[model samples]
Target: MIKVGIVGGTGYTGVELLRLLAQHPEANVDVITSRSEAGQAVADMYPNLRGHYDLRFTEPDADRLAACDVVFFATPHGVAHSLAGEILDKGGRVIDLSADFRIRDPELWAKWYGQPHGAPELLKEAVYGLPEVNREKIKQARLIAAPGCYPTAVQLATIPLLEAGLVSADDIIADCKSGVSGAGRGASVGSLLCESSESMMAYAVAGHRHLPEIQQGLEEAAQSDVGLTFVPHLTPMIRGIHATVYTQLLDDAEVDLQTLFEKRYANEPFVDVMPAGSHPATRSVKGVNMCRISIHRPQNGKRVVVLSVIDNLVKGASGQAIQNMNLMFGLPEATGLNQVALMP
Candidate 1:
C-alpha cells in the first residue's frame, strides 16, 4: 500500500481528503498535520471521520513527511511551495490543493497571490492537475498543482470548445457562482452566517485571482493566448459551483453536442456531457467527483453557452487531489471516487 501524509488537516479541504482517502483501497493515510490542533483526535474535530481514522492531528515535520510515498498539502496558498523541495528530494510525490503552483508564470502568480513565490525554479516542475486534460503528465508528475474551485468549473466547461477551435479565444466570459465554503475554514467577516445566509451578491468582479489561472489553462489548451472576463458571486449555500461560460462561435464552426464531447472525453473518467439541450444542476454532482456539463445555442446561433457544475470541495479540490494521487501511483483514477452524488 502507498503510505500517504496530509498537511493542514484541520481545514475544509483537509477534512475532505480524509473523507475520500479513507475509502482509497490502495493507499494508507499515515500522517495528518495541524499546527493548532496537534495531539487532538481528528474525529473530535470532525465527527464524520470518527470510525475511519484513529490518529490525532500533529505538527508537520519535513523529514517525517518525506518518508511517505505521497503527501497532500491542503493548506492555503504560500504554504506548500516552502517545503516542496525537501519532500521531492526525499522521493515523496506531492499534490497541492492550493493556488501556489497552478499558474505557470511566477510573475503572474506573485501579482495575483500578493506574495513572491517561495520556489520559483520548481514552478516548471509541477504539473497542472486536471486529470481529463493532463492525465499522462499526472502519471509521471511528482508534483501536481490542483486547480482552484472556480477555475476547475470554468475551465472544464470551456476547454473542449477552445481545443476544437469552436469558440473565439478572445471573447470568453465566465459568470460563476460558488458557495461560502470556497473561502476556506477561516473566520472571516464576509463568511459570517449573518452576512452570508439569505443573501447572494457578486464580489471580485474585475480582478479575481482565479482569472489568471483560468487564462493559463485555456491558453494551454488552445495553443494561443486567451483573454476572458471572469466574475464570481457568493451564494448562501455551503458547497458546489455553477459556471456559465459564454463565447462567440467561430465562423463555419459547428459541433454535434453528444458526438464531439464523447469523442473528446472518451477516455476521461470524471467529465460528463449531458444529452443535447439538457441542463445540469449543481445537485447532480454534489458529493461526487463528476463534472456535469451541457451546452446551448443562443443569440441566433452566433454564440454558444456552456453550463457546468461540481462540488467545490470534491471535483474542485480534495477529490481531484486524490484523483491525481491515484494517477501518480498507477492506480485506477476512480478507485475511491466513484460514489453517486448524494441527493436530498
Candidate 2:
C-alpha cells in the first residue's frame, strides 16, 4: 500500500482527500495535519469519514510526514512553500493542490498572489498536474502542481482548439460559473447562504488570479501568447464549475470540431467530450472526478463555443491530486477515483 500523509486536513479539499483516499485500495492515508484541529478525530469533524478513518488530526511535522510515500498539501497557497521541500528532502513525493507552484514565472505569481514566491527553486521541476497534458511528466515528477478549479475547466475547454490552431488565440473569452464551495469551507460573508442564494454576481471581471494560469496553459498549447478575457461568477449551488468558452474559428478551419474534441480526449480517462449537440450539466459531474465537455458553433459562424463542467472539489481539487499520486507511483491513473457522479 502507498502510505500517504496530508497537510492542512481540515478544509474542503482536505476532507475530500480523506474521503477519496478512503476508497483508494492501494493508498493508506495515515497522517492528516491541522495546527488548529490537532488531536481532533477525523470522524468528528467530517461525519462522512466516520467509519473510514480512525486517525486524529495532528500538527504538521516534516519528519513524520516524510515517512509516508507521498504527501498531499491541501493547504492554501504559501503553506506548502515552507514544508514541501522538507518532505521532498525526506524522500516523499509532494502534490500541492494550491497555486504555489502552478505559475512558471515567480514574479508573475508574486504579482497576483500578493506575496513573493516562497519556493521558486522547486518551480524548475514541479510538473503541472493536468494528466491530459502532462501525464508523462507526472510519472517522473517528485513535485506536482495541480491546477485550480477554474483553470482546469477553462484550459480543457480551450486547449484542444488552441493546440490544433483552428481557433484564433488572439481573442478568447471564458465566462465561468462556480459553486460556493469553490470559495472553500471558510466563514466569509460572501459565501453565506443568505448572501449567495437567489443571486449570481460576477467578481474579478477586471482580472482573476486564474486568468494568467489559463492563459499560460492555452499559450503553451497554441505555442504563442494568447489574449484572453476571463470572467468568473459565483453561483447559488454548492459543488461545480461550468465554463462557457468562446473563440473565433480561423477562416480556413473547416474541420469537424466534434471529432476534434472527441479525438483529443478519447484516451483520457477523465475528460468526457459529449455528443455534438449536447450541453453538459455541472450536476452530471457532481461528486465525480470528470470533466464533461461539449462543442458548439452558433449558426455555423466563425464563432465557436465550448462548454465544460467539473466538480470543483473533486476533479478541480482533491480528486486530481490523487490522480497525480497514482501516476507518480505507477498505479493506474483512475485508481480510487472511479466514483459515479452523484445526481439529484
Give the TM-score of each candidate.
0.98, 0.99
Candidate 1 residue-wise lDDT, 223-336, digit = tens: 998989999999999999999999888888867755777788777889988887888988899888989888888745878888999999999999999899888888988999
For candidate 2, report its TM-score: 0.99
Model 2 gets an lDDT of 0.95
Give residue 174's error in model 1 in angstroms. Answer: 0.2
Query: 76-143 in candidate 2: lDDT tens per residue?
Result: 88999979998998888899999999999999999999999999999998999999999999999999
The residue ranges of model 2 lying beyond 4 angstroms of the native Cα positions read none
Residue 329's C-alpha lDDT in candidate 1?
Answer: 84
TM-score of 1: 0.98
